[model samples]
Target chain A: MEALFAIAIGTLTSCAVYLLLRARTYPVLLGLTLLSYAVNLFLFASGRLVMASAPLTDQGLERFPDPIPQALVLTAIVIGFGMTALMVVLALRAIHATGGDHVDGGER
Target chain B: MNHLPIVPILLPLIAGSVLLLSTKWSPNARHAFSLAAVVGQLAAASMLFVTVREGPVLVYALGGWAPPFGIVLVVDRLAAALLVLAGIVACASLLYAVARDTETSAQRFLALFQFQLLGIQGAFLTGDLFNLFVFFEVLLIASYALLLHGLTADRVKAALHVVVLNLIGSALFLLGVALIYGVAGTLNFADLARAIPALTSADAPLARTGALLLLVVFALKSALLPLGFWLPRAYGAAAAAVAALFAVLTKVGVYAVLRVYPLAFGPQAGELANVAEAWLLPLALATLAFGALGVLAARSLRIAAGWVVVYSVGSLLVAVALFTEGGYAAAIYYLVHSTLASAALFLVVDLVAGDRTSAGDRLDTADAMPHGALLGSFFFITAAAVAGLPPLSGFVGKVLILDASSGHPAAALIWSSLLGAALVVIVALSRAGSAVFWRTLSPSGGARAPRPSLAALAAPAAILGCIAALVAWGGSATAFAQAVGRDLAKPAVYVDAVLGGGHAQPDDRRRLR
Candidate 1:
């Protein structure tokens, strides 16, 4: 389970980096979204992955998952969503103004 | 509990909301409310500065919840001083925007500006790591809107880079926080400090990586050498007043470095003591040299001003990397001086550029500006101050840094680089000044340029006056900076005030479950 989780995050990050390094704005935006997904997953898994366990429990359970990472991930998701929307609008604006989609607003 | 610490954050938040809700209001009314908010913030920041100066660190718990379980706002001398600095910059920059009609030209400009302030002040005051990230997002988002406020092709391109880069920065910040929390089981800064020193061997490596990752995030924000290439172009493209407010933005990164590393990873952190010291100085020096060269190579006055800001950050971090009492003091003093001078420089650049119809801030000969004498003098004084000339606060700041570094092992290297950068900056500014002001073609067609209104001149003049005050009150200012330095050296006072022993419950997990 640990290896799978780590490998998933590693793959996502690598792909994100690749897309991010592209010259165009759309690729960069997609890369940012992927990167945010990896980050959210990493944050959630930081709590020491537990299966089918409630974050907080009143019953006398021997083990329960930590809750803060969940909260952190939730916040990251919301912020990430807002930022992605902003980037989309900004990319559209750049394309409209500069007549190109390259990050520098000039076609290579 | 004294509520002064939270006022700086709340004032802007309220003002921004008001401005956002009242879209039909007159520009005059919006400007009045926004300026009033900033002025109130200045007053509150001044009172908070007084309260924390010789007094204790003020900790304000949100909703009466204790630390380690809930978020807290901690204001020491450093945060209060920065609060005061931010307020002053916001006031001047917003005033300049009003005078230039930049704010009225864009939708929701006033609200976005206030939100930017809210984020800055909140970042300064928050005691939780996650809370800091939240404020960073707040500020970055507001800045994005503000950057594109007067939308142009140049602005859109610049905003794209700034936004994408910062989004990546945000991801890194989150990853670092997660690693730290996973290892230490806490996000509250004081609790992390308490927990880090006791981390087991296996956990130490994870914690160390987390700390270093945080350093990357901050270095990027502060525009340190390798991570800062986006700065000059971005700042150069921004509206002058937005760029000026952004002069404080880099310092936020510097402030984070100052606040976090010392408290959480100081000498007490066993293996992680002074974790950032190794990479800080060399990169800082390189950044300084890079900035100086960038200034020399810049073709436009605005870009040169941007490089000047980068140069100042380099020097400020060099002081911080020294990790001594006097070093922190010098860094604080330099922080104040550079922020004001750079912000003022941006405004002055705007004014100079506006006065020239054909030249448009390019460092080449053109028809002479109309307000040549007045604007020329402003540029000269600002350039002199930025380049560390005598009889100015920049010189005092440079001297303090030099004196503070005298005891370090790399004193020779530090001295040479600092002096070399100063000399290079002087040569560059002089060349820029001559090209813009001195070597000018006569006005074509004999059409004299119209004079700028007093309102436009007043903002930069007010900020320059503040720099002059820093020099005139050098003794007292330096004394205050040293006191702030001393306060930071001892982290126990900060931790105690935030956690206060009896208030923090160690077993928050069990209590929650």
Candidate 2:
């Protein structure tokens, strides 16, 4: 199971890096979103995977997943969401103003 | 700890929110309010600095929760120094901005500026790694909007580069935090120091990778050598007032490096001992050389100022790579000097750039100024200070750095590079100065030159005055830096203060299920 998750993360990151180098803004934005997804997953896995148990404070169980990484991932996800939204708006504005979709706004 | 540590973060947060809602405020009223708030911040931070400058670490655990549970803000002399420096720059730039801005929408800009301060101050004070991430986001988000305040095409383009690069860096910061927590089971710096010593090799790769990733994140933020491509363009595009405030922003990255590398992964950190020093030194030296070349190649004064900022970052990191008390003292002194001098440079360039409309910031063109000689002297003094000429704060700071570098194995290389970078700067800036100011000097030469107003001159003059204070009080400031250095060298005080001196670790953390 861990191997599967690792492989997925690796694939996502490789694809993200490849797309990040593209000339257009949309592709780069998509790449950032995908990269963020990978990062979020990595953050989630940092808690060490658990099955069939939640680490509720009321229920003190020996077999419970660490809760901190969940909080961390949730925070990261919210931040990532905001980041994506900002990037999207910035991209659209760049395209509208410069009449170009290239990342460098096509020769200023 | 008193309420002082939290005050630095809270003051700005409150002011920012108030200013954000004050849309009814006239531009003048808004400027007054913003100035009042920054004055409050400076006062609070000054108090904090005085309290911690030569005293014990002040730790404020939010909600009264101890380490590993609640967010912790640990303010030592180092944090106090950065806080005070940031405050000074913020205050000076506020004056700079308020005097020139005529639009009522200045309220929003002021609000954003306050929030930026909040983020920067929080980043400096926070003892928890995850909190640092949150603060980084706050600063970056605020900066993105601030960079686009004027909404020009060039500014927007530059903002895009800065935003995208910083967003990626944020993701990496998250990755690093996650990896660190995965290995250490805690995000608190003190806890990490404790945990790192006790860790057996659980792949060992995880911890090392995490450390390096954190370093990379900081490197990107500091605009370290290869990763610094975004700096010149983004910063050069900013208005001079905004650029002046940004002078301290790069130093925040330097502060983080100084804070993290030594305490969390210092010599005593078993698994991650000396991780960055070996790699950082050579890279920093290379950055200096590269930045010097960039300075020479720059087409515009604004562009050259940006390169000078980069050059100072390189110089600060060179001291950081030394990883000694003397090195850190030198670094801090240089950090303070460079911040004031470079900020003054940006302001000076702005003053100069406005005179040369046809020249349009190019170094080759010389347009006459209304008071070309006075402005010329200002430019010369500011550039000379930046280039480390004698009788300036820059020289004093460089002397300390040179004094600290003598015993290092790469002493000769360091010395030569230090002198060489300064020489290049002197030559380039002098040439640009001569072309822009002296060669073009005339009693009545250019029609487009605006009269040099007192408001226009006030901010840079204030900045130069501060640099002069640094020089006049150079001995005292050096002593303070030495004290800061001693404090940094003994991380035990920090770790203990955070964890409640001599207190054992909190036992709430359990192993992975």
Candidate 3:
């Protein structure tokens, strides 16, 4: 499961990097979204992949996943959502104001 | 004492929400509320710094929960100093905004400014990695709005570029956080410190990959080398006050790198220090060279302001690449001086613009209040500060960094090249000085001369001049730098405050679980 997750994250990261390299604004936003998912999962997997176990423990259980990473990842997901929304709105506004969505041709 | 650490962040955050609700009210009321919040924040930051100076570092856990399971706010000497600096900058910029005749509505401007202040203070104070990300987003969102406040064609173009590039950076930052979490199973700075060493000892590949991801994310935000292309454009196009506030933003990124890299992933961690020293040194040199060249090539005062941003990024990376106590100290000192100087330079540009407009009207008057002479003095003094002239704060910081690089041959080379480039910068700035302040229109009689409004804009420049003078005097400022250095070199003091012990032993971890 960890191996699969790692591979999936690597794929997403590469895709995100490629899209981010594009000159246009929309693809870059999409790229950031994909990257955030990969990051969220990567953070979740850092606790060493406990199978079918939540971070919160039941009675007499010897171990569970680490609660700390779960809590951190939850915070990150919310923050990531906020950042993505802000970027989308800003990009749309930029297009309306500047009449161009390309990052390269803007005034220096 | 525990609760005091969180008040600086909480006050502006609550004020921001209230301001959003009160948008329907008169601009005066909104401005008054925002000003009150900023002043309150400044007082809170000052109180927090004094309290931390008197005691051990202050730690405040959210919801009264312990660390490793809850978010924390840590206030060490370094964080405290930075918090105070952010407060001062915010206050000064707020003052400047109130004085400017720009088209931005006061209510909207103050609202965004206060939110940005909240975000900046939060980033400095938060002890959890995820919390850092949250505050970073807050800061960025506020910055985007503030940058677009004036909504010019040039500003819109610049803001678009800034948004797109920063989105890429944010994505990478998230990826890095996720990767580190997957490997270490904790995101609290203190927990990660304990968990990373054990993880790296067990599996080298995981630790190496995670460290590299984080380095990239931080480099982008801090505007290191190739990733810094977006900064000059975005900062150059924004209003003077807005640009002044942003002068401290990238430093937050640098602060994160310093805080996390040395404490959590140090030299012992799987080639981490080596990777930083190796690639970052070359990047630092390249950044310095590029910034110097950019400054020389710039045609307008606004464009030169852009190059100053590049110069600051270069100097920051120099400190980071040195990776010594002295190096970090110099970096911290440079961070403070550069932020102040860059903002001052931007403010000076606004003054120059005002002078230029008045000069354009005064075509025929030969002795019409030598606006050019006043500007000439301002530009020369500012250029001297930026180029690290003796007796200036910039020089003190640069000398410290150079001394820190004494033993490292590569670092010394990089430092020397930077000195040479600074000379070139001095020359370029002098040429700009002549063109901007000395060069005049043809002597053909055309129109009546208009009086210059030097009094209106002199306040910001005078404030910067006094700060530069204080830094140059050096008794108290030098002592402060030494104190800050001691605190940074020994982050154990910081970790203990947040975690309540030096390290979390295996036994303690078992007990907690």
Interface RMSD of each: 1.9, 1.4, 2.9
Q: Candidate 2 lDDT, tens digit per residue, B1-513?
A: 478788889999999999989988777787888889888988988998888876688889899887767778998999989888888888887887777544313778889999999989999899989998999898888888888788788988898889888988998998988888888788898888777666667735687788889888898988898889889988898877788888888887788789878887888888678788877999899888888878888988999999999999998899989999999999999999899988989888877877676675787645565667788889989998899898989999899989999999999999999999989998889888887876664444446666657876888898889888999998899999999888878888888778875454535465434
Greater lDDT among 1 and 3 belongs to 1
Ordered list by lDDT, greatest first: 1, 2, 3
TM-score comparison, 1 vs 2, better candidate: 1
Top candidate, metric DockQ: 2
Q: State candidate 2's DockQ.
A: 0.74
lDDT of each: 0.90, 0.85, 0.74
Docking class of 1: medium
DockQ list for all candidates: 0.72, 0.74, 0.55
Which residue segments of model 1 deviate by more than 4 Å? B102-107, B505-513
lDDT of 1 by residue, B162-233 (tens): 898899999999999999998888888888778888888888999999999999999999999899998998
Q: Model 2, A10: alpha-carbon shift in Å?
A: 1.6
For model 3, residues B1-513, the per-residue Cα lDDT tens digits are: 357888888898888888878858887777678778888888988888887764467888888777876778888777887887787777766666766644543666777887998889999999977788888888988998888887777787777777766766776676677666655656788777667667644555666666677777777777778888878878878887888789889888888877787777766444344445666778878888888888888767777777887887787778877767777777877887787778778777766665564442222233233356676677677778888887788888788778878888785586678788888788877877766655565444444334434443554575466557657666766666666666666656666667775445645665544
- The CAPRI class of candidate 3 is medium
